[model samples]
Target: MDAERGEGSPHGGDGRLRRRAFLVGGGLAALGLGGTALAIGPDGFRNAYARVVCGGVPDPPVARPGARRLSEVEGRTVIVSLPPRPRDRTTVVIMFPEGTENARASLDLCSADRYLAASGGRFAVAAIDDWPSADVVGTVLPHLETQGFDTGRIGLLGWAAGGAEALRLAAQLGSGRVAAVAAASPAVTAARAPLRDLVDIPVWLGCGERDDRAPQTETMLKGLRALGATTEGGISSGCQDTAYRVRVLPEQFAFFSRHL
Candidate 1:
């Protein structure tokens, strides 16, 4: 057999050489042969692949306890409730994500009551109504006060679109009333309003590596960094089944424990 045409030869007549040559030529073409490389480079391709294969994280356990209407403001109904363990010292304020009936469904699915109870009575959970056009923090402040909550020790938590809303509320309240904020797959787009001074507040951001909402989380992180905020982020371990994972909740609880 001719040396160049042997099975192990780089230029062998076998199919492998042709395939390798095609791949190399395609890569060079994509790189413009001299100019800047393609915007979607090899790394981008890999990331896209990972997202497609891994899927989104699992949703946190739902807190299903009979809902009690707390107040009605601007045609919106706000609610408050005690978690399984009503004697918990920690107070959690949850801002439900935006949209219609689905938003309410998300609040129910989150099961804030169950989460707090599972945390060993470490938190007393409360939730606001669906997305509204007013200052949610201001709307709920009075109710929280009546409930004997020390606003200074309160932690803000939100899910999906509500995550951004929660952060915005926290920023508005400042570090005095809100000690920390937690978000899961926040809908952080360019058009999303910017958060106020958050440099002194602690923030926890959670997203599934393969979540469709990853871009939003990335944008939120960038905004937080610009404000010189102290931010911690993590990839959820369970992204193959549920749309979000549980790591964010525990991590958020820990953050509140330390800060609040």
Candidate 2:
């Protein structure tokens, strides 16, 4: 955008911000070789871009309850929650909300308490901050292992942009390497183009049928299924926006539990 019309990039001086500015309103769509196009509008992307310049921002304080604490790993602040009693098989659930502030809240929003209790000692829910790359698994897993987490049966659950990361991580890690992958209102722009690499990993995708994000999620699921990825997807009936409703929490949680 021109200098006069400056709603594009939050930080107007940088070349990087200039490029990101174009995506500020329209968001990003995934398009590439033999891949289906997926659309993710500016809402989640804007939320993510807002965190880019947060150089000195502090991590969100631990407030949500249930054996919660903050850990600085790989220069990223991760919020981890554990159950009262753990199990032999640890189901590490890595969540990627738009920003650190939404990390812990996403868990509670999903009613992690019931599932975590039902999961017994088998599940650990961790939410990450920043624009984490696929190597995030390497960054988070070791810490979990050192903390007495079994490091087996890893699952990825995400909302909006974070859902994109969840799916991307599953692709990077591949089938058996990742036990289950669930996403709520996954934004197509969150994942890079060429989703066929995720053909082996099963994805449980949920979207609000009435939201603008539904078309995007449906397109993404169709493309992945065409590639032979074992996938299950549904539109939640009682939501206004598809980004993590009060309903799909247990539905997705049950999927993860079955796989774990």
Candidate 3:
């Protein structure tokens, strides 16, 4: 497990703009305001703020040759991105988007499809429009198998509250069913009831050192280690924003590739 750090602090003209937007967007999120309003404010903040902070107000992913969307999985829509040359039976990475994002937007934010394509079809990426629970995994796994994914080897990725859901799902399902998990700024609670189930699971946890969730991420890392779980993680320099995602995602993808 390598320690990765994001370089530099927000400064200068562009950096100041980014820093300002980050503060505004984070404040809005804290107030439970809709991202739609933040991204499309009546003022020109959309062009100036979201462009730097909220990942430019993610658009619905464009329909293309290799892109696939499925609506038959228990009435939940799933967005799938296969590698350029997918294998017959490849591992799948399921993404649990943060509250403000949809499946396609989540995938876009993480650049997951491009990473899979760069992997040369080593694995597939799937994002569910709805947050998943342990019960949902039973449905998702079988459905993915039907779609040519090797359901036995599955990776879970998520951010913010979604990351907490991924952890809860991994705990409920256990390591036998879930191959690995990668979480960024997960809003994990202090409850230790689920720690035992994660002992056998491979986890990679990351968060921005200045982010509100940093303390919890540290606690989780310590808790996992105390349980002897194969855990690897680090705190970087950004928050729950786009820069943090850029810094952590490549390593997260590599972590999944190794375990899944």
Candidate 4:
């Protein structure tokens, strides 16, 4: 979470109003994790942190005709949907998160939507809610087809735990429905047998500079290279935010655009 800054004035015409307001606001911020700062403006107090977290946030409802909740896997319900323009050539993104199913942090599929829409409607993006499950992907395929997507051209985008899942699913599919796989901040380790072999499709892996799991990502990349896979690794400057390294998504978009 990012730190916050705030400013305010004291009431009752106190000479120390500004100083007092600063102390109070600072105290309030100290008690909270992921607090944003505010400043006293002509219109009164303004919160910068709230702006960052809530800025341009979209509604949670998936309102398209084919946009509906699918059956739950292991008690967690998954969502499947098609882009607004369904007839275009489609690409599927199987998203898996590193947190609880209900958290808003896992709702970053908006970026994926934007990417597909910008690509001449050449792709459709679908975010799966369950952890690395091939069954979930299989279940969502028909739902995507109902939305008019070409499931044969779909791709996978996995982050953190989902990255590991993406690799597993890629190997499981073996170039069937999946065209490529992109793993951002993948929690790849030597223990996974499926990830040991290099995937035949294009694979892109990335991590953050301040991420504690950089070593694990590097190990996974090395393993993929050893398997004769077409692989690329990227590094971002910021720390992990909501299980995603912000820069990795755009890069992944470019990779998918080129390969998928």
Could you tell me every candidate's TM-score relative to the true structure?
0.60, 0.63, 0.71, 0.63
lDDT of 3 by residue, 139-173 (tens): 77788888778888578888888788878888887
Q: Of 1 and 4, which scores higher on TM-score? A: 4
Q: Write the per-residue lDDT of candidate 1 for residues 32-85, one digit (tens) a residue.
A: 431222355544444433434554344555545433436555566655555554
Report every candidate's CA lDDT.
Answer: 0.59, 0.62, 0.72, 0.58
Q: Compared with the true structure, what per-residue lDDT tens digits does model 4 show for residues 125-217?
A: 555553544365556676666655567756777777777777777887776666778877777665663654446778888776667767677
TM-score of 3: 0.71
Clashes of each: 7, 2, 0, 6
Clashing pairs in 4: 4-37, 5-37, 5-38, 6-38, 10-17, 91-124
lDDT at residue 162 of model 1 (Cα atoms) = 69
For each of the candidates, the C-alpha root-mean-square deviation to the true structure, in angstroms, is 12.2, 12.9, 12.2, 8.8
Cα RMSD for candidate 2?
12.9
Question: Which candidate, 3 or 4, has the higher TM-score?
Answer: 3
Error (Å) of candidate 2 at residue 13 is 38
What candidate 2 gets wrong by more than 4 Å, as runs, is 1-66, 74-76, 118-121, 129-135, 189-194, 238-244
- Could you tell me which 10 consecutive residues in candidate 4 have the lowest summed lDDT? 1-10
Across 25-86, the per-residue lDDT of candidate 2 in tens digits comes to 33323212111111333344554433332211233223343577677777766677776655
